[model samples]
Target: MSRIPTRHLGRYLLQGQLPRKGCLASSNYTPRGSCRVAASCSCSRCLQPFSPQATRAVHVSTSSAASPADTPIIPLRKKLKDEAKQLKKESRKNKAQKGSAQTVDGWELTVGIEIHAQLNTSRKLFSPAATSFNDEPNSHVALFDLSIPGSQPLFQPQTLIPALRAALALNCDIQPVSRFDRKHYFWWDQPSGYQITQYYEPLARNGSITLLARDGIAPEDGDSVTVGIQQIQLEQDTAKTLAQPGDARWLDFNRVGVPLIEIITRPEIHHPRTAAVLVRKIQLLLNAVDACVSGMETGGLRADVNVSVRRTGDTATGRLGTRTEVKNLSTIKAVEDAIIAERDRQIAQIEAGGSVVGETRGWTLGSKQTRRLRGKEGEVDYRYMPDPDLGPLLISEDLVRHIKESVAHLPDRELDELVDRYGVSAKDAVSLMALDNGARIEYFYNVVGGLGKRLREAEGRTPQQPLDLELDPDLKKYAPLAANWILHEFGRLVTDRSSPQDDETAFEITPEGQCARVPVASLSELLFHLHQKKITGKVAKELLLALYHGNVGEAGGVTAAIDAHDLWFHELSEEEYGALVESALEGEDRVLKEFGGNKKTYPQGKLMYLVGKMLRLGPTERIDPVNAEKAMRSRIEELCGTSA
Candidate 1:
């Protein structure tokens, strides 16, 4: 390279396609060396990269979007957020360590529920004696139930039907090969030393029931949640244990060997309200099917709820936090309190960076928090085995189908049908379905159906297609009216007047069971008289009350009460009643005199109202408003001056 100018040194000059020396930017640099410039190169005054006496072209470098310094040791700001959160948590812990407490979300509660219902039976499961609640101790206990030496169980086919119905009602798949097992759990009341249950083979499996927090919700509404049924099995109930605190626990064996159907739900409930609602649903179902005399306030039917909780996103696919069991929660309020306490406790542990222990805890009514009882154990640890003494229950296919057919009506389905067919609102239908008397549903159908048929015959026409009560000429007007009376007025009579238990003991017949106890012929006779307007609604209420109070015998029944108590029977044929109705028609002079003196503008409604008022008066000093109004209307319409 020619030393073009003394000023050009240590700088590359662009030549055709070869490297050429450029003007010298650094006075102390040489050209033949590698492209390394002086590390300390700078403009003399500015102290930046420059050389004296050299006009060098510079390519300004742009900064990158990121840098190694800017990037975290890992990458992204999520890590920073997480670290900050962790640091805050640690600070809280340190504060707690410094004698100041900090609260946070910690342990999660998990819950599983086991619901037991007494099966409807004619005789005790393993006994010849009767199966009755509230009976004297040992009264209903057979030798087998008492677990006397060498005694054995005798299967009852009738007892199994209710259990099967329950399983099907829950949408469970009935297992063809379910077997019974002996579950060992010691209690003072367990005469047999073991509970006969089904662990390996359950009667039902893989089922779910929809639960609505409040009533009247549609099944498809997301507000309704599904609760999974782990299994439903038939078992024998233990005897009642009456405890005396410091004294010995007295065993009352009357309930021993009574058939029980146990329903175990999977751990799906997350909140307290959901738990309460689930319990109510199960109880209602049992009541609806007449399977159990469930008294939530009492222990006739009991619920065991297990609860637990865990950190959110603790798992890759998050499940609920680990839970603890809240066992034997009899009251809905108690269940609510237990869930709240457990949830708070779990969240606190997790937030404190401490692990929560899963265990069975009993809820204290006064303290409102659960105390640990025993460590959580899995099902296999229960050591369930087949009962060696009892052979496998072989229910024939015919038997299963026949049992299914026997229960022609399912409450849930009937409830829906009532809503759709009768044109009844959902809420009204729910109330009808909630009636403790299962027969009321049938009674309602018969009342409406029979009345509609009579009306159709009077009109000389067949009932309309699809038989909509609202549209049918005979029934459209009265179906809802009848439903209201049956659901409300009649229901009140049944509830307020009926004794809860029989006279011999405190055990009363179940409302649904009571319906079965009533002779069908007697009920039909009562309804027929009422439909003929032979009795007023007031008398009907008294009659029903008398019937509910156990007054029986053809002459001594409700009809007698109606006779003795009715104040309006004397008004049935008052001479003044007819005069009042006729006066009401004549007083409408405007109608008869105005319509070319035609009766087209007749005050028919006012006349009927007056008639009804008179009919309501007591017979002794009363007038028959109904008969008066009817006579007046008939006479007015027959007048030649009136429109035909």
Candidate 2:
């Protein structure tokens, strides 16, 4: 039996190359998150390829006669039917060519998505059972989760805040009064034979998520596509069925009664990559509000995308063609790849004279293809009804107001502050704050606050107008120096060494449990020195390493950290620096012959390598390398000035 593959969400993504959005979504990506599972887990939900030694079931039907292929559920057009026959015949001699995803004979691929986001609450909804993942199977089930006799569900009001925060961040309108419904189902995992959800009266509606356009413009500054949010409904999740070491399967109700918010998007998406962009946006938003960790391997968030196609001339009001629902995509990359694959599958069918069937398909990571699960069911199949046991959920305007007041500096607002207030690029701000947890976020803002204070002190007031990141004159002075050290340097030091279960714990407090990771003063002092031209970029990086290793003095500041590390850049006398540079050219006869004898250009690398060695200033030395490098270039030009 093959074990399931999952993301090791314990270590956050701190090493991947930054993408277009500046989000480090590479392996264990902060955005396209990697699977994080323990060796003990045996769930095969991901369906990754197994080893040759792994047990797998393969059926071999020994039939002598030729059999027909599985009949396509959706019928084909006469023109397409003939094309498909010819295609099948040609397939014997040559492999089928994959259709171009961007434009398949003028068929426009439109997509919609439904996402399930697990809330990061302490306890499950309507139950006192804990909601931690990977607990011993069946340990967290409450009486309500098990649907025991005389067991009444009691709501946890705190869970509502994350839901509401997501609604506001996604630009959704909150419902003053929402009600719960019982969705009838008979899955073995659901002990109650139904699920409690807000089917009719949801917590919010009319929200929208914006995706950066992929094709025609720069991803950062390009025109964006705004997808409509159908609704965000609050719901109670069902238990998971896990296979035992042998053939037995057990219900792990640890997930039962866990709070979930289902975000359904309107079919406003066209490109396959656009679907991924939207999912990433929501994932980060959920991460921002602490609504969900968005860990796909552990089932914190999952996406179901519906893809369809129509003729090029079809108008926006035209009836939508047949669509296939590819369900249970575990990560942002999975969502993107699945949608693209499905779209191509549909195009191949049509170009070969076939139509698409409306059905539910499951993405198999092992094959990178979608397999038929079952026919797509309509709302009537779920048998939704008002829950008699639970009363209508009442959300007062005052409650929304109160929660809104508390997180005024939430991620979206923080993103805007970095952009409009501090002149940071939209992409850079996202890279700086998007996937990090609350404590790291707190540390992030404190660093930004320190910069803001310094700016105010220098200018005496906020600048009169907002500066775009490209045109901003002041960004080079503060943002680059401050944000780079904090996000990249500090992030790598912490997340790279964090555990596989929870990266958030790494920022909880110092190793001594006194407070969170390095205090703001440490960073403030470091930035102050850099801003004061007392240290070069090289020295700043050395100081950052010192801070990471706890080399700073307890009572002493960044200056003390610097002294202890001997990372000072010394100011060299012009005469001393000039003679030092001249000496680099004097020793090598081949170079000296060139300097006096009209050599077009000296060996820049060899001479600079030696120049860099002699200019190695002492520990307390404080020469600004930015200016020193410029001065070195001028002196080199004078040495080679008169073609002799």
Candidate 3:
């Protein structure tokens, strides 16, 4: 073997080509187009051993007939003329371990995301396979999903509505004419070997999502980052593949042909924290619009993250470092973790006189480094073409207008209403809409509406006004109060851990004894009683929990439920109050030692607390604490010369 001469390694990356060994001054350098792809390594074409030499690859010829400048594929080093700069990055992470922190100028971090949202449609995109989870494996597969000889996929017009709804909510420019293409790939999950997707012309494009700065992001630096949405396309879900005992592979086609909307974001996210926030915001929006359930635990929603780093101060401009594509991040937390880990890996590689290789990587939940799945060269070999089975989708004008009317309340809009219209505190508003459970939020409105009606009825006025209107003065007092109880106390009542009385696996239930949920109307009525002083706050909280759990038995209605459970506040009878006052003033002469038979030395406030405590042990009674104090003071004065 000839010893290789040392040289600056910039010529290997050009025209979408990676030099297998040439980029890193490898001892084994084969000229381009020399060999077949490696059997085990999974490189697209290069047979050389997988190395850590990272750089962008665009292969060009030095032939006299072809001009390198004509291709617009000029290597990045040519523009900057900095071989020394490429050799070493700022190494700020290492420096920060010492005392001083130095800001690394000229390096920019860029991130893009591809989100897969399972469409909440009745049937699959192409086949009539029932779109349900946990069904028998392969039970839901249709002939079209398996690509039978004559079976063809038929488009469901109803499924198009949901895809359009998400696109419109994202502020995307919906393309009236979009066509589907076939993405060819070989995997155990995809029996059809090609995925039907809108790629050549996607469903929507050129939209943006705005995320508020969070996780201690300083306002002076930037209060928010608006990442760009590149496109939103409708696609078909593939089957799930499971690795079994003895390294065996199992295929479950139950999820095949399920509809999905793929939202691709631009390389706008700079920080890992920002990427997490952006994905969370999009997930909430998808939930709000009913486009996806956004349940990472259930595999209903997932994201593919594209993270790249550059050497520029502003994230807006720079020649990017090689990026690693972290695939199939099921959780938002995992996305953030993977990005940070990949970034650190790239920075370390560059610092250690190696380049960051662009490749497909996987993340184990607790691990910090990404595991390589495949190289960038192999991953990009998915040859795409127009599908002969499908035609261009023609979205009518009426359809767009109708879909727009359907999605009236989105996450941002609801947050605004909670603060501006309902007078909910801004901080409280965010927590309310953060998850974007439309049903839960809608129930909140229903409960508020019920409160308004009940208050108006009490005032002997018609309860016909719109609940959206500023409620009657009587009900207005409970707006913030009710929100506090619902968001905090009542929320805890339903979602918290099981009590001693509850079963280990607690699920939603109702007081009716049927497999039903407690009605929002009933909860509102309970709150109404609390607001009107018919029940104490403590009674109200217990009452809500009682109804939520099975503690309360079956009843006729909301009022009946409260009465049946005896959750109403009880006022102390005059006899009980007098007896308590007498006991405190005259103590037990035989059993009580401290302050026994010493009425003149007893504090009036202590006597009142004793009286209240005795009452609390029995019932939460309304006692005019102030008047009780006054009466106690008078009684003490009458009994003793020194008590006053």
Candidate 4:
């Protein structure tokens, strides 16, 4: 038998590039040059053609004519196909493994988040230049921001107020003494050659946030995850870099030197949804405390997510697998999806006999995947050094105490209170808190308060006193209904009528601007009338729109609006209701034929259709849908011979 080099033999078999002659010995063990396996001929010694196992039995001879270096390179497509096959085989094996069904292909994912939120301040962090988001390019740049010679860093003390509020809101421990350091990096947008940031000593550290199901973040009801805050650092933002066509770029200094607060979280999140929820929770908390303008849409906030995956029972060295960081995830959905995509990518790489590389990646919305951006940067690469101009920051205990006192309850806490105090559902409470930054929540509370006062007055009790909704059943029943009206009816009306604005200036200039057209008292009166059955829900909605569009004057509140529009709910007598029902069903033979029977079941759709026809036959505002349905059901039973 003649021998061939192992590399040549394997490459030939794998690529199907075997020479037509003398590729393999025949079943009779002929000389190498006399046999061919490409045809029907087979080699008993090598088992089969193109089999990976055949490579092991083939012996390599030093006397072979071709050296290993002479072997042909594998094509990219072939390599990809082989990798895909390996990955699929491994996936199937994992599915068959013990406990695979209990986990994500028997692999666990861990994630940590770093968030950079721009502080809501009028001036830059170190320079006195004004800070604005949509201003002209380079208009807000200060001399110091330009990094000209002789320019010195001038620290702004006011920026710390919001930073301190953010730290307190996040439950971080405030550091009495912290200092700024220079993070050295070369980028066109960063003209200073380095960024002034709190590195060695951040503003705060070791805090935590508990995400509750009521907050609508957890995967299941009654599930709560408390993620620990690693640190909160004060930093300066880089200028905006816009890529132009043909490899050109535009730099906007309007965002240069903007104050930023970086909040880092420990690697505690195990699910993609939870990670996204944590980012959203932080944005809400910061917005609630007036700490930062956490608008992901406006680039006011950004998140970097670190994702890694490990086998369920892999305990070697008690270390986790290498992780990849997905950077600059602007939206909450992107954060969750990037983590999931990166996790799957790493798992697939590992399953295909490859190792996960520690690198930086970017999330592509078009493809919904994460692509490699660059290798991850290490601490040493930044070349951190203390800023020469800025000294150690010293905070007085009085200031910390004052800031802590000023910091109201975070969104999660407020959410809990809203659900527990009022009879509102968890879903409704979350919606209230999210709309217009709790402005709607306050409106809802005012409406509830007004209703409570009215109830007290009707009971001949103290009308000006506060009442516990939990103890008073009448007040409890109205809270959820009030939430529904404010969130659904009133909120929808205002949102549709109000023109979209580029910034929050309209909301900030007049906090009550959105709700000013329709007063809380008007909504309170409207909902009260709804509860009293003086008007149906449909009529209430009409009155709401009327009040919003100024068609009805707000001088006398919702009562005046209803009267002006003649939207008062009317109840018909039995005779009148029966006549209307008969007229509605007079010509509708198909509806009756399909649904008419002595069976107990009735076609709800056809019944409602008849009720709708009856409503259209008369003044809808005057007809209560409940009464109309009852009248229609009775008339149908009489005509059709049974109540179906």
Model number with the top lDDT: 4
Score each candidate by Cα lDDT.
0.63, 0.70, 0.70, 0.79
Deviation of model 2 at 524, angstroms: 3.6
Candidate 1: where is the Cα deviation over 4 Å? 1-110, 212-223, 244-248, 286-300, 318-320, 331-341, 348-355, 363-381, 406-408, 437-477, 481-644
Q: In model 1, which range of ten residues has the least summed lDDT? A: 10-19
Query: How does model 1 score by TM-score?
Result: 0.56
Worst 10 residues of 2 by lDDT: 9-18
lDDT of 4 by residue, 1-644 (tens): 76867866876766544543544332334444333344443466433334575424452222344544576678768888999999999988976742222137678888899999999998899999999887778888889999999999899999999999999998999999999999999999999899999989999999999888765553532478899999999999998999999999999989989999999999988878778888887887888898875478778999999998899888465678898999999888888778877888888899999999899999876455798889888889999999989999999999999889998667777777777777678888887876665567777777787777676776688643546644665656788888888778754764665555512322221234235566667777877888888888877787877666656664777787677767676788788898898789888998888666555666888899999999899777678788889998887777777664
Q: Which parts of model 2 are misplaced by more than 4 Å?
A: 1-105, 120-123, 128-130, 134-137, 149-161, 211-222, 287-298, 315-317, 364-367, 394-410, 448-476, 491-519, 533-543, 546-561, 576-625, 632-644
Q: Where in model 4 is the C-alpha error above 4 Å?
A: 1-103, 218-222, 243-247, 315-317, 449-462, 465-473, 490-521, 547-550, 553-561, 574-644
Instruction: Report the candidate with higher lDDT, 1 versus 2.
Output: 2
lDDT string for model 2 (36-65, tens) is: 443343445323554577454322222322
| Per-residue lDDT over 275-392 for candidate 1, one digit per residue giving the tens place of the 0 to 100 score | 7667766776776666775456657677777766665455355666566776767765676667767767777676789877768878777565778888876766567889887777
lDDT of 3 at 208: 91
Best TM-score goes to which candidate? 4
Model 1 residue-pair collision total:
43
Q: Kindly provide the TM-score of model 3 when superposed on the true structure, using C-alpha atoms.
A: 0.67
Q: Give the distance in Å from residue 201's predicted Cα in candidate 2 to where it truly belongs.
A: 3.2
Which of 1 and 2 is the better model by TM-score?
Answer: 2
